[model samples]
Target chain A: MSQIPFTDIVANLPASVPFVGPEQIERERGFTFRAKLGANESPFGPSPKARDAIQTAIEDSWEYPDATSVTLRQAIARHWDINTDNVLVGAGIDELLGNVVRMTVPPGGAVVTSNGAYPTFNYHVHGFGGTLHLVDYRDDHEDLDALAAKAQAVDARLVYLSNPDNPMGTRHTADAVADFRRRLPTDTLLVLDEAYSEFAPEGTNPPVDPSDTNLIRLRTFSKIYGLAALRVGYAIAHADAVTGLNKIRNHFGVNRVAQHAARAALEDQAYIDALKNEIERGKRAYAEIARRHGFTALPSFTNFVTIEVGGVARGDRLLKALQDRRVFIRKPGVPPLDRCIRVTVGPEDQRTIFEQAFAEAVQEVG
Target chain B: MSQIPFTDIVANLPASVPFVGPEQIERERGFTFRAKLGANESPFGPSPKARDAIQTAIEDSWEYPDATSVTLRQAIARHWDINTDNVLVGAGIDELLGNVVRMTVPPGGAVVTSNGAYPTFNYHVHGFGGTLHLVDYRDDHEDLDALAAKAQAVDARLVYLSNPDNPMGTRHTADAVADFRRRLPTDTLLVLDEAYSEFAPEGTNPPVDPSDTNLIRLRTFSKIYGLAALRVGYAIAHADAVTGLNKIRNHFGVNRVAQHAARAALEDQAYIDALKNEIERGKRAYAEIARRHGFTALPSFTNFVTIEVGGVARGDRLLKALQDRRVFIRKPGVPPLDRCIRVTVGPEDQRTIFEQAFAEAVQEVG
Candidate 1:
């Protein structure tokens, strides 16, 4: 039988997934995790109002969601005090990352990102046949200055940075970030990912001028509003960037429940404040646990905490040991950072379970 | 201010929206339709079990959905008695259509579809810079023989056909479709969109055959399953096509609620039977109404019925009149078929409202 032929680019691309979910791990191992803390999901759950909105919208699942997502975008704009014209909502920051890459990057086009930054963004750049220039992180944070310089040197079309960074939970101060943005080449667009911005220190996120045409800031309901499963995220950019997104985005990509739920979640400020407090409590508890276990907890501005385990091999072993004891956690893949396991803040119960598992894993690995 | 430059293809493409959703129309008119018959939605709602699943999963909206879509794909595989390797689920048929087009159509490649067939498929083809070859419908049905000939003549990379066709609500027997599939060139990939398959008469859908290497069948929960708002759909093809999708697909595109709801919907055969019966009743009622109004109702295998309004101008006038009466229905865009207006089957109450509105619109247009 003749086989179906794929495009040369698709044929050459590897069948790779960015991150495997905990459910897939369980399915493969025939064992479920006792504490599902690996994926940085908010175990505190979505707002009660968001849940109510989802339930109310259940019966209307027969209709397609509004293509423009007008209400949700308006709500997001009001919350941020920005114009709706500057906001573009998508499935998640992940999908938005894919879109931005597809828009600017062509075959052999230059794009720059940190070596150990968000892999999904790199995956998208690769999928679109772009040449990726990787810059190494400095002092456990995304080195914005180095990224900007590299983009200039390579004449990159795009540069990516995630503030309140993942895996290491490190962040650059607002002034530092603003300085880096000003220093970047005018032609290169900066993708400032603030997925964890809500949990960052008050002044950690720079007050980006919406009129700044060269930068786009991505934020997510996944982290702060606690609606990751609904998959809603937005990018705040100039009107041209937003309009350019319309040229390529899946217009009705946002789900109806997501739209309603995200709007409600954005309105429930009290719920967000309460969740923030809970996350702070979890972070402190995790730091205490790390101190008691003889590991050094990295200074963090986000919900997750990362602790140094002295060696990458030892960190991997400890992570495996935690999984073996029914606790799930993830460590960075690159060196220096690979010596640490990143744990997201959760409810007291899951945190306690993670603490006990971490102690046991540390002892075993040691 | 300097503007970020887009890729050559992106710069060359026109700013176009594929479809104008009914919600946009309602927003612009500042009036809600009393009888919402456009967009071919089920209107009967999803299965009871699916509704319950969505409600139960509401609280877990903070967590990301399983990236693999394991449970839903497993259920789909079992339903078709095919291996899991043959199935790949996505946000919806719209997304899958885009993916298929991207992988098959290099820039300027030829794609074949009927003149006024599903515009979303055509939109995807255009989005990927594919040249579209349109064949006119024959006797108000998609001309399968003509489509095959066009595909051969154009050396098309992809040929799209919607069984139990949209806009016209017409279909051919399974044998005729299978014969047409056999006549297509081996190099041409056939995208058989069966979005309305569940509402089709018996023998309308070809038997599931995973060994057909050149054929890929698209199915959706939007129609018979009534989960359009949830945005879940699947493509069943040979393993090669299924595997190729991974290279370009958004891995976490399907929402969690959609996956759970679709799984529950697949298991609720009783609910599906009831929905099918309701649709049949609605179809008969519509046909009776058409006869009473001196219009001819076309033979339909799908959930909607298309009625001839004499000519293109009459059809346009009738549609406008219906809209003025706060009833929303759609007509095909092409010449001969434009003489008809298509109405979807809704719940009993909505259909009664539509019946009254149809009478008023006909009298006014006359």
Candidate 2:
């Protein structure tokens, strides 16, 4: 019998997953890690209120989730001082990114993003058959001017930029981002991912511009809100963008627990503030550890610290050495960033254990 | 600034959601549903083991879900006595259906489905720019033979058939479906949606044949498994089909709680068997209620019963009257199925309230 033919775009796509979970690593390695610092997950768990909300929502799992996610969407809108029409809730930023790619990028359409910056976004672009124009990072920060220039040159449909970016944990100032947006072509949609915004200092994110039809700001509960596994995220954009997303988004994709938990997490600003303080302390501790090994830690605004590990080969050796010692960590895969290992800021105890493991890995790799 | 133009396909698509959720109706009507039988969600709730698993998983909400969904996929594969490579887990069958469309139906590609079978499937087809070839249902069941003939006539890339069908609550025997599959073109992919298979009697679903590359059978936890809000579903297909889906699926879209809860729910066979017996009783009760109103309840093999409401006008009138009484139920939007109203087989208490409301609705409509 003849096999079903895949769409041309999907037929030529790679089978590799965007990011492997730490759980998969543990399964393959046949043991649990002493510290789970990779993937930039929040080391502090969700707030007590959010956990309680999740437990309370458990028995209600027989009902379908509110398709519009009205209450959660309203909460997010109120939190950002924006109208409800400007917001769209989804399974996470990853799912929302996929929808955005589908919305703006037709087959063979052009998109732009920094090289080695959020592989998942690039995966979505490529999955939808968009031609990606990769602009290399300059000095560990996404090159906004270069991205804008490339978007103009290609007449790109979409351009992605994550402020307080992943891997390097570096960020562009809000003013810089606003300037970048002003420089981009009027019709090019800029996907401003603020997944790590909650961990960043004030003034890192631009004010919500609901009138800007060419911008969509994505935020997630996965970072400071600490509900990554719940898969709740939202996009703040012009009402037109929101309507475009609603036309094709899986209405009931976000689960009931995620809705309730995220609302509770959003209400608990004190918990977030306390967690941010704790994360700052952990960052300082991580930086100190790097200094102890005569290494440099990149200035970071996000929850993770990227420590320069001499060179590309040394970074690879150090990463593997840490894994061998039952410590989970990640290093960037691209050239300049490959010389640094990214580590999540954990609680004091985890930080202590990770520091010891890092010291040992460094010595062994040397 | 010029608005970021949507892809031509998306730009032309209407901004209509597939289903108006009960919660959305409650919000619009400014009251809670007295009897929510509209969405066909289980009133029995999830298995106690599954509830326990969800509670246990809440603490780990900081971690991203296993991207591969390895353990749950393996459990589903073993339960069906199929190889793990044949299984693909997703947020729900809705998400899986979208991926299947993406896998096979290119832009302007032809697809076949029963008219008014499932609007969500049609929504995905239209969202992806596929040309729909809709065949009318025959005798309250999906007309598989007609669907196959149309698929061949149109050179359709994908055809959807839901056994133990939704909205109508009717099904075809396994032998009939097997014959239907044989009549289809070798290149056409038959998406056999067995969402309600657990509610059907034995010999309804065809035996798993992983060698058939053109057939993919879908099952969900939202119906008999009683975890609608958790949003977990899986497809059993050939490894090639599985690989194609993996290439484009949102790898971490399925949440951690869903993975754990669905696995526990699957293991609790006793809960499902007992729930099925309860559902059968509820169906009989519903039929009796229909008889009291001089209506006919069609032969049902699913959790819901579709009662003939005399004519299209009465079906529309009764549906509105029921909503006026705060009893939420649905009817097929296309004729001759539009002459019927579909109601979920809720627990005894819910059924009693629904019976009263339904009786009131029929009297008012008449």
Listed for each candidate, the true contacts retained, as a fraction, are: 0.71, 0.87
Stretches of candidate 2 off by over 4 Å are: none
In terms of docking quality, model 1 is medium
Cα lDDT tens digits for candidate 1, A212-291: 88899999989878898988999999988888788888877898999999999999999999888889888999989989
Q: Which ten residues in a row have the lowest lDDT in candidate 1 chain A?
A: A1-10
| Model 1 / residue B346 / CA error / Å | 0.6
Task: Please compute and give the TM-score of the first chain of candidate 1 against the native first chain.
Answer: 0.98
Q: What are the per-model DockQ values?
A: 0.74, 0.86
TM-score of each: 0.98, 0.99
- lDDT for model 1, please: 0.88
Model 1 error, position A124 (Å) = 0.8
Off by over 4 Å in 1: none
